[model samples]
Target: MIGCRHRLRMDAAHGRELRDVVEDSGVRQRREAAAAHRASVRDTLIAAAPDAWVVIDPELRAGARAEATVRACEAGAQWIWGALLPQEPDTGRRGGSEILMRDTDRGGYIPIIVVNHKVTDPRRPGPADFHPLTSELSRWNPQPDKSRKLRQQPRDQQRLAHLYRMLQRHGLASPSLLGGVIGLQADRILVHDIAGVLDDYDRRYADRIAVVRGQSPTTPAKVPECRQCPWWTRGAEGASCEQWLTERHHVSLVAPGSRAEVLRGHGVTTIEELAAWTGEAPQDWQHGPFDEAVVTARAWLAGAPLVRRFETVRVQRADVEVDVDLESYQEHGAYLWGTLLDGRYRPFLTWDPLPTTDEGRSFGEFWTWLMSVRAAARAAGKTFAAYCYSRTAEDKWLYESAERFAGMPGVPTVEQVREFVDGPEWVDMFQAVTEQFICPNGKGLKKVAPVAGFSWRDPEAGGEASMSWYRLAVGYDGPPDLGQRTRLLEYNEDDVRATLALREWMSPRQPTAHSAVEQVPSLADFALDPRATPARTPAPVTASGGGTLST
Candidate 1:
């Protein structure tokens, strides 16, 4: 219910899922592991509670929900594990909770879900304070001040709202309208005021129900959600959203989200129309500058994925440059630091599963090596810079590893990380790309690097796939998979190499060369046709593949 609306509509229509050789085994493993963790935590949480009516039936047999309801009504047992709440079909809400506890009033039960991600940072201030041992949820009282502010996990809030509404329908909900979630740290249950998010959940659910009932058309719009959606590129039974967008040269092919919709309202539906647009801005235009949008559309049509924003394009380069890439498993410590300097690909990695003691040791070694390289460059009086595709992920671990392993030898201090990140010595290639060029096709390393003639050795070199490989490599449950470990190392190495390739391509080490902008086609070069070339011969068939055209 909380997923993509298009996916929901398709599911309601019994749409066939994409049957491609998808790499979902790792995703499956992650889900399974999370479920296992949730189950283990739930068991531990309710173990000390008195007579917790544990529902073990996975199928929720004929009388399971009934029995659970009867037990919940008793109110004697404060904790109920694996609760199968009664379904409210009219409201389109039905689900089970990992743990349901008696509300503060004890008049009804409130839902508690166990999730894989962290719900709150103890270091930060939040809305509620919960005690796991007693399962008590105390609302924030500024007088005493004990809160770990809400951690932007809207799905959990929506889910709690869903369960709360279900409880209300059954006459077993408190007026307080609250719920709880036990995150990765099982010691704490981050309770929430479900009342705050109920309206949002209601609005979303009502709209999704309309979509499911075919009352709303699931028109595919090019957005962030489309990346993981199966209906992208192609669907199981129809021409995909990709095909539809391409055929019309949809403005969204370049401009994302509501920008394209707003453009359409201005009679600019296709990329060609947007490129040709020379009119003044609408009275209340809030979308970005008209000039930039037109330039992007022109870039898209000309197949120049990136267009220079100015006459001159430059990237920060140094005599001694190191391309860096860091890999981590979903919120678990960063396990690998891959660096490409000169021509060598050196990797600092831990073979053990992440969140292990060895992670600190590995990180310490990597930090020491990196600093040594910088120190050597300074000693030689040669300028130095370390480059990463994006600094956000790398910057996070750099500071966290320091804080996480404060006393560990060789671990860089938070101040050191801050200095490096803030200084010009640490260059972000993605930021450079953003500053120097407008990328119509999007600026992801995988998307932009290929334009710079960089390709990964592994076809499936992505964060998602790496997670599964990490699990197998570390032997999460069984013997170590050496092949997977090798794959991970290779992937990490290639990532660093890709960044290096992008760096050299953007700002060549050679004294004189055509910059990225000078090397690619410009709008004038595509006067006849966006894709046309002077040396190109026309294709034998028609655009629709109906018949051969006379050359």
Candidate 2:
């Protein structure tokens, strides 16, 4: 019989509408409908029999009393039926099994069944998969006495043991019919005996709740809850009190970790206090004096010396250079690859994805042009190099395009692409920066670009933001916003220019110390081809504007 399942909040009006639809459909198939209705009516009549069954919908506040009533019935209620509810607020705990266990002392045997209508996927298993009928029941015999006693164990343990027995009864079962009647779908089932784990979790949860409510003075040894805890705002305005104490006072960075306890033991609480305490290093402390010194310097200095081990800032002079940056949609593939050759910015764009003539077509065209430029440089006895901020995306896409279109005429072979990536012809400024210095701010192109006096025209432009623009450009959700494409191109241009700026800053010709204003030589001054057009010279602004250099 088909049961009309709905939420507890569903009003009588909605129920009437559903009943009308069912009745109208049932009338169309008269004989079959009558049989189905009879079965449903009979089931309802049997369920209504005095103390035969107790049904509860635990999602509603009223369900608590329903559950209490079911518990009060003791052995009289032979069946406990429940509708799966949303988990408890904030705690994420499910109340179905917990409600059933309300009367632990008055335990007899009640076959519990929970209906979960939220599961729509046919492949997914239902409650029957987890708690199958016993083998004795399958053989048309009564359940054993031992099996009845097993139900008195903890809910998790009882369910797990039942599943284990069912599995054993079926002899390493298949997804089809396990016994004469029941089936087990292997792909969509998960069962675990987690009674001990649940007990531990419950104990810990109680302890944490006690700490949060200030009923206990002692904090829990773990503070993973700090991120989501409402009490996180208790300390400072801008930063958490915990963070402020940790940073300023050399306290252990990780809450509840032994380092903070160690520091407190030694009375080296604040940074100033720690600095003064030149006592023998605590054997338990993870960091040494050298690490402390580095942190102290960073805290005090506006521009601390670069961490040399991580830095490799040296100049590699090239006769002809092209600062290259690629812009691509991860799903749709690379669309725009911008190249700054001798200050002139050029972009190869693909707006469509027609096979053999889209992103692939654009890559092929760009590769051919690049090859020609390199060939010209080689013939002139000059070295040509393509520089990108990072090798990850651009290098990956170049190799991918090469491999994808290996047989296509004019596209580079995989071996050639590999050579270009591995050789000196392709330079990654990210590697250059990493080899030269450790940046506390970050190693991202945006982070390091500012150090080299580089900035984007559009503040919102970023790798992820560009992908969002690409989505709009391709009309993925709605009509394409062409303006987004222009903004994306501008962002890409800024990226390539940032790499050029970094290269200039790292040049050995520049002063060693950070300068308020360093003259940056124009790419035109080092152009290999006299015929190539120079970039348009903008009106001279401050050094930050990144205009053409006089020097």
Q: In candidate 1, how many Å is residue 141 off?
A: 8.5
Q: How many clashes (backbone atoms < 3 Å, residues ≥3 apart in a chain or on different chains) does model 1 have?
A: 4
Computed on alpha carbons, the lDDT of every model, listed in order, comes to: 0.74, 0.50
Model 1 scores a C-alpha lDDT of 0.74
> Which candidate tops lDDT?
1
Off by over 4 Å in 1: 15-23, 47-59, 118-150, 233-237, 261-269, 276-290, 521-551
lDDT of 1 by residue, 1-551 (tens): 46667777876785545444474665576688698788778566556553545554566684676566556556555666777777666866778777776654546777788899877654445444542221333222212225444457888888899888887877777676867787886766676778878889889989998998899987666877777666776564477778977888878888877787688788877887877776576555576676677777766655556666655567888989999999998777899999999989999889888779898998999999999999999999999999998899999899889999988989988888889899989999999988877777788888777766777888999888898888889999799999998999999888888888777776777736545436544434333443322232222212112332232
- Per-prediction TM-score to the true structure, in the order listed: 0.84, 0.49
